[model samples]
Target: MEQQKLEKLLSKMTLDEKIGQLMQFAGHFYATNNNKDPVTGPDDLQVSSKSINYSGSVLGSAGAERNKEIQERYLAQSRMKIPLLFMADVINGFRTIFPIPLGLGASWDPMLVERAQTISAKEASSAGIHVTFAPMVDLVRDPRWGRVMESPGEDSFLNQEFAKASVRGFQGENLQADGERVAACVKHFVGYGAVEGGRDYNKVDLSERELRENYLPAFQAALEAGCELVMTAFNTIDSIPASGNQKLMREILRKEFDFDGVLISDYGAVEELIPHGVAADQKEAARKAMYAGVDIEMMSLCYENSLKELIGEGKVSVDLLDEAVLRILNLKNKLGLFENPYRGASIQKQNKYLFCPEHKEVAQEAAEKSCVLLKNNDVLPLRGGKIALIGPYADNPDILGEWSIFGKKEEAVTLKAGIAKHTSDYTYALGCPMYDRQETALTEAVNVARESTHIILALGEGSDRSGEGRSRSSITLPENQLELLRELKQIGKPITVVLFNGRPLDLMEVAELADGILEAWHPGSVGGTAIANLLFGKANPSGKLTMSFPRTTGQIPVYYNAYNTGRPLPEGSTERFYSRYIDTPNEPLYPFGFGLSYADFQYESLQLSANELKPGGSIDVQVLVKNQSDYSGEEIVQLYIRDLVGEVVRPVKELKAFQKVFIPANESKLVSFSITEEMLRYHHANLEFKSDPGEFKVLVGSSSTDLLSQSFYLK
Candidate 1:
């Protein structure tokens, strides 16, 4: 659609019709009779029939036939014959699922993450979805937040990289929205991940510097990558509900970030403004949301029923309505919906592409690269010995983590199934029930363990335990599962534990008992295949911890790169006055970037090109990485830099750059990084982003705790 045509079309819509453009209804709103006519009406809805008939968009995933029928009926009855935009939550994949976003973060390869989203776009677009609410891109440090499963991890720079990759993968090059791709929607605007107490939809209160320095960068990166849409958060930002926060949305997001895309409310957040105390009712909610720069009201009738009245009474500007409608129209046009409303949506395409082998291969590889080997005492690479596979997840294929909406658990292969392909000598039994100990089941598992030469135990939270409203006060393995492990430990056989969950968990007991541990964080779809291969030495665990694994649940929000406190605990000191926990250690159980590989890697001396970094010039930093083991493996070399003196107190060390390299057995590789003035920028107390002239430290390491360091000057 041309600019002139879109403007002219907008000029002709009535008040009711124009307001309808900003109103989105879920798919159930337009139930149709077999006669291809909508049998449902706006009787229950507060909006008039005209508004319901002219609703601009529908939310939900449906077959091509159903979407086509809905669009046909909608157009036939529309006064302007406008096409209805369809959107769905296709975060990981529509059907051919990959690992959850956090697991994708652990992969730490943005290009591979990009490929996964591209495949997600392909399958989702085939199902008549024009937009996907995905690539969460929120920076989460707390594992208690269920949607941490949706974030890349705690680091801002890594999240930024994944955010760009996710946006690019969904929209593709040139930002052309075609049948093969769905427009990407970067979500929850700002600071949804920093919700207090790690509770869902909790209030977010942060200083301007904290918000900008740590939280705002990733959203900026997504916008820079040309994300087409932004979703408002369900919680309050600076005490104002995000959908109704004018300073945050209109000033920060719309102006500061310069995002000119459509801004939609997350689910029913628009109406929830009343509960947030910012709106008196739905009408006030609509008024505040519109003024605050929300273009589309999702799953709510506020915009449908009250906008016309507000505009008529001069309480709200009709111009804002026009602006919102135009943005929606522009997005629909960008998606090429005007040219072919039913593009990329066909049962034929769905049958040919969904759950196809090529996509599953990608899923398998993603799973392989995403599983972190946390501990291995030479018990991995299981030999030709009889195996006992026991646990709730041993034969269960519900490994598809939460928010994998379109994926089917029955279609996924289980760890038992994957191991069976290698050998039938493995005996399997129940390692207790999922949440409790069944005496009979535990006895059976112990008997099987005694009969076998080794044990491959699978355990973790159920899929429902860590998504949306599923927050846990105690982030530990279920007591029964731990009891089962304690029982199996008496067998005195080497045990390898495969952890299947979404967020980082307290693994102290499991770590102590298991000879080896594979942190398989809900490797999706063909995750079983990846797990099986790694157990038998067919594949190597290359993934690292994007989020820190706490030693105990008390360290709920633990992360690397924290600020160096004034009374920082002395290294190896148990001083009482220092900032130390009385009971637990200060460090995480496994710090960020921590992982073990079958192949051993050694880091050589750190090298720097210069002692001082001058303005507009860059200093080259390098480290030699050597593989000592016989197996060839991929290594993610991470670079961290710390500002010794800043206008504001800086983090102890922040991840500035990283590279994923594959080295052959007994071979060495040089991992290099270039540090410019821009890389040294930080948010001061006044919120200015610039570097300070001072001493700095550069560190290269496999993880945050294990590092080789050197000092430099920036002038």
Candidate 2:
């Protein structure tokens, strides 16, 4: 009965009012000096539809005072007085920033990631923003792609966990009742991570099985977490643009998965479909997108200009328009905007929440957790050594990384500043500039390394090198950065390389040359302090790699959970038929879920309660972990599986579960994982998600590539 009442109310809406709900535009406004493409419009200027004379949804511009004013203006002019929905690309922070998504994923603590999102929602909502285009759950492996920093790493299970965490954190209990929560938008919808050659906005091609097996899980998890909105991808899937793919948006997302929330297009994605060769023009693009399932056209005027005309010309059905409007209205009603749209537009709260001290403290903690220690030698923790800090990123503040929407860079502590805080026994030098190969600079770096008792070479692709619209064909230390490192190595100094990249890179040289290497992939806000904490032994580095670090660019699609080939490689054979690379080892520079710490940790044994189980049975798998060194640290105990034989051949190794255990020095801890029939499932050729009764070998250890195996069976 309530559903019918809501439907009746939606049905009575005028065409103009219904159309108004479909438009969204950028909201950011600043001085001409700071704004990107600022708009200069008259008092009553109408950019598109007469109904949306006052924008339907505001993006970057509306905040607090502006939000209340805009809502008032829209309400007064409209017949139904519908309130405007405000959105922003509040990816990491509204005012208080957290570490980038990739960094948070490295922590492998979903609860921490959840809290970060919860904090983000709190800050964003306090400032009048209702939706955040966040929890970008793309399963990205290539570190060359700049946006990889914004993803939850390369593993499917880890990504799925983080996806659920972010959704729960952002949405809380209910969109209507939770005033602190904001709607979460699972973004870049379908396979934005598979951009060709790791370049942003490139094409993606993968079999349906591969897509479902790997890439699709994160998005599906977000949907399952009740994410209220899904933003379409900029990339094409099977040559069809996602913004206009009925098979993806309608068939898969809406009908199959039952995502009842609004399907919003990425910025200018609807219009870009024409250039993508999927649509003829803006009108056709808008028509196809509307029919496909996109409820809101974000930052693209295609809907405002073409949808009404398309409906009149029979290019689109009124039913489709009505359906889209209903979805939008439902979201608005769910947000409680219909009850009182100006709920979040509080100037006092906005002012108080923006850059609050507590928010900064949480941001600092997030940055600390995201720092992954890729390699650590006994020489670290500085204790009290004469250290030389060298590199462009060492003193740089902009290295807070991409999507740092509101992070105050000027206030960000640099590596030099952070190290200075720890100890006064430090000198500074600018090694070869990032992405530069000047011989004089290289010589200067060598001189500095030779002079200091210990050297910390801060290096990486600059902040601009990775993120959206940024993709690299070759993800290596640019220019002579590696050459400079090699030169520094010749100086016979114990060197610690601190990386500040946005994506994964081929760090083979650093792996071999540097005594200690840290993969600090652009930790945001308190990033410097976090790295400093690890360097000075204030915090034990426990974060692991979310993505695999390839040894070479040729290994583009490398990941740990890959399918086994019929002609599997023998341990000591050099046979050509085997699935092996002739020139390079198939192994990566570092495997996914791989990390190192100052303290040594050992995995003792894997013990399972039972070796056999029934269809609906479950068992507890336990592993004994001991911290052998004198220092305390954390270890991520990863669990993988091999089905040996299946109806369909499976990956030689598939990551099943993992736990991050923190143990004090000389302490032994037992890590237990519960396995069930559901955990044994695999997607069949027909895409039914279920398990086949079979013998399974569970491998538990430090990283995906390294482990100890134990056998189990399900009958």
Candidate 3:
């Protein structure tokens, strides 16, 4: 397990064995140790038996006895006894499902987010997982990108904090010290979130400045927090595929960032280089990936088939292949896999940790904090009324979002179950089909609505509608579900729309009809309980939106903190020549960091330590947040900075710092933030990350749209 031992093991590996270590395949490649023969083999890929035994890692594996069986089967067949590494897409949670990462971003409490991930690590490790592809820190400007749910949100600074938190939570203080921890792998290396037209695996074209200024920082933060691995994106960066882009994978990631950790290609990406027109054949693709510094090829045979030939010939060196093989072995050694191949993997651990009551409590609390209350009109906190819970998700329990591969959907609590906990004076109806109009279902729902004093319309995209390869051109509620709202609005009862979705939706129609709208974004296993608690007065909603909700699909990439154009449209402008939209407003329906709590928070008497700030000096900005309503709640006090003049054009406003404060009913809390010159620094035209001495404005507010402003000068 030590370095000397790892090197000795690496030195003994044959050419075929060393190449096998760099090739990754799905979980089906490994046969179980059970008495029955192996059901799936490497036949389709035409991989040999020796390579199957020596292959370094496995993907999409269900942990517990199944993993132990595979490890036992593999070790028995291995020549050097090198254990197989088990990695999974354990993203947010493994079995005890938490909110999607977007929902975690809405919480804005990284420590709380960290707690949830810690629970995820505990659960996942018990299932025999060694690594997780998580904390996807890509900056998303386009909500139409389905995988946007996997990212934290649009801001780089906030996502950086989440990135660090994810690394800390998953890797912990020492990954090898305890079997409970799994190494964190921050993925889609660079600019995968900004795909053309918000489509998955499409072209990712960005200027060097745009790439450095926005997308690269979060990955830097993740690595700085000691993320153990980097996964390449499927898309191309600078017209070169990220899996085979030498400048990005080799120079920037290796030399500049100095990430000595393992670099693995995304699923089947190394083979796709041929289709990308970057390579002529699989052999050429393997050569390019090795030259580009890819350590491992996931779900592909390009490396398995071509690497041996390339190394034998003069085209590629054995040294390049050795460096990658050693890295993979080093990871296995660090994970204690060399010491114990079935580390933390047992039926006993699974029974004790998976879906435990304590873990489920954290999942419930997280779901409660993650559900954002986007709009309210004094119709919330449903103070005792005959409630009509109508829609597709009423009794259905598939509220767990995508990437919840290990969670049992049947174990999830239904919305009806949560409502029963509050009161039985509620009628439940499946109002309409999820994607189509059902007139009979609609009439039943309307009739129930007529008898109820309040109508709760739970509607949004299906769980399958917004994960990997699930991009949507239209980002809004279907007319079938919207029809339920239209028919119920005629009854004119106080309507509260509960949305179950992954991405920020175009709520132009629902915003007009619903009196209250709560974004319960695929609120995981305890989603129903979380929603019901907020519906009644049991809990207060405190989640804020991290991504902007577009007014229409046309504003696909709409977000706060965008740079203004040369010819900017003035507020409330009717001018045609200025940069503005013809049919919709430039602003989103709901801006970032926007949420409402049952308790009203008022910002007053913003004060600054000094009117001028100098280099290496700090200024303390303070504001008093008072809760006016009787309900005690948590409020996110946001601090945004605007550079009035810069060497280059800056954003209208940039979020520098924020604090989540809890105020008792009718009490006040003084929220303070210290701003230093380093926080004001930006990447110049030449990519110099330093601050410029200029006038600046400090805006303190609850959300991006509503703010109280003050000014200062950096001298």
Candidate 4:
């Protein structure tokens, strides 16, 4: 399918057919209803038989055989015989579920994350999925937002790196080349993660400088990596909905970033514009979306019903409609769907790829690396001791996080089952329900804890408590889980709390009650095995936290790299006039890049190759990391920089680069990082991106709070 052929096909399309190419709906719209009633879901978007016959694409449909049947039916009716493209929300995995994106972000291994996406692409393409709405590259700092689980973390640089990795992994080097690949759609285009009060679909208000500085970098990185599609956010940016903002879509994304990819609306966002008070009716909604550069209306009938009327009244131009349709045709041609309608979809390939043993091994490895040991008190590595596994998730298999549409919970191994393989001397007990207290369950849990030498208390939010539209005002453990912990503490046994959650929690109480805590954030299919290995000294935990765990819910947007205030509170100071909290400290309970290893690591002798750096020159900073304990483990050596004086106030510390290094027991390794002039650049008050001649401080350590510092000058 060449450009000339695509243009020729476009030239022959009728006005109705061209408009149909810009509409996407679910496959259920085309399904026959035995009652002969019109098919309707939660929304009032009616799908007529004519709309189904001419629809260009289908959403939320899988299975090679089923997709083939739908495509055949659609092509038989389409005047131009254009094949229907199948897309789904294949965020993490299709069948062989990997850890959630937040957990993968904790691994801090882009190459490993890329491999996981490659596996996701392989399984999804086999199941007849041509595109995935994934690699959500939103920079999140608020833990109250449930969608934070879908993001990488708080840093712009880390999110940018993972964004590029996801794009390369999904689309591969060449989309039309050999290997199982699906077109990647990097989503929530503009400041979706900065919703007011950390609520879903809330308003987002930020200056143009803040938008470009904090929000737009990761999206620009995704576009630079050659993502094929872009999805708009549901929220409003500066009082204008992102789906209908002409300046954001046309000027910044098109002219500035040069992204020529197809821009589609988030689920039913175009029709919701009327409620947003931006439009008076469906016809106005369709006009605004098309004029603002939204090429496709997802899960909505606004475009289907109003575009033709608007065009007839001379409100909308035929050329704008043709351009949108051309983008769709271009994407289909790029996917090679114009030639082979089936692409990589086949029942045979689905059987061979989905949940294969090799793919399972990668999931296991990812699960192992993603478990972060947040606190330890010499109570871990239950070697030859009778264990008590107690909680709702002790024997449950719903550990797979949200957005894993194709993964089966039954196939996932439970924690009790995995721990049983290590030792048969372990006992199990359901302490309580996920969110409620049960007296009989608590009594049985206490009896079991009294009979065991060590207790592994599994607790946290359920799978449905977080991710997309599941925001929480309080990010603490449930009262039942906390009460159970208090009751278990009186048994006088050493307890290790294993937390399975999607977002960072307020662990101040758990930090005091439990002897040890491990943040096992919704470890997927092989999660139980990975936890078992880490628990019984079979594997070492190396993951670091990407987001900050606050001391309380009041510190919603807490992160390590925050700007200094005019009146800053001194460390350990209780001055009332200074900027300090009376009830809680300004610092987080656990800082970003914070994690513990079985083997203790020590940082020593921070050295710099040069004391000064000139424009276009680089300086080498080196630090010696030693495994002080008699156990081998991996360490994430973090490098942070601070501009002591800047044209605009800078953060206290910003993570520039980090390296995950493996050190043998009682051995030392030298980790070196080259800092270039680009690393020192920042957006000035006037939005000028350049470096200033000033003194800079470099810090090297395992976490943001604990660091060894040195100074250098940038000239």
Once fitted onto the true fold, the runs of candidate 3 whose alpha carbons sit more than 4 angstroms away are: 32-46
lDDT (10s digit) by residue, model 4, range 228-281: 999999999989999999999999988899988899999999988999999999
Cα lDDT of model 2 by residue, 439-519, tens digit: 777677777677789999898887788888777888888766777777778888899999988888888888898888888
Instruction: For each candidate in the order shown, give its overall lDDT on alpha carbons.
Output: 0.88, 0.81, 0.90, 0.90
Q: Write the per-residue lDDT of candidate 1 for residues 1-715, one digit (tens) a residue.
A: 8989999999999888888888887777765333344335333433344555878988874678888888888888877888999998998888988998989899999999999999998988888889999879788888888888898899999999999999989989744445688899998788998998989989998888888888888889999999999998888877998999999899999999898899999988999999888889989999999999999998778887788889989999989999999999999888887888887889999999999999999999999999999999998888889999999999998899889888999999899989998899999997788898799999999999999998999999988998888877788999999999999999999999999998999999999999999988888999889999999989988999898999998877788989888899998998799988999999999999999999999999799999999989999999999999999999999999999888778999999999999999999999899999999998877777888998999999898888899988988
Model 2 misplacement above 4 A:
1-9, 28-46, 49-54, 437-447
Candidate 3 per-residue lDDT, tens place, 1-715, comes to 7789888888998988898889877787675323343334444554555566768898878768989988888888788898988999988798999999999999999998889889899888888889998879999998888899999999999999999999999999988888999999998998999999999999998998889888999999999999999999999998999999999988999999999999999898999999999999999999999999999899788888898899878788988998999889888888888788998787898899999999999999999999999888998899897999999878788788888999989989877899899999999989998899988999999999999999988898888999899888999888888888999999989999999999999899999999999999999998999999999979999999999999999987898999989999998998899989998889999999999999999999999999999877899999999999899999999999999988889999999999998899999999999989988989898889988998999999999988999999999
lDDT of 3 at 333: 81
TM-scores of all candidate predictions against the true structure: 0.98, 0.94, 0.98, 0.99
TM-score of 1: 0.98
Please give the distance, in angstroms, between residue 1's alpha carbon in candidate 2 and its true position after superposition.
14
Candidate 3: RMSD to truth: 1.7
Candidate 3 residue-wise lDDT at 269:
94
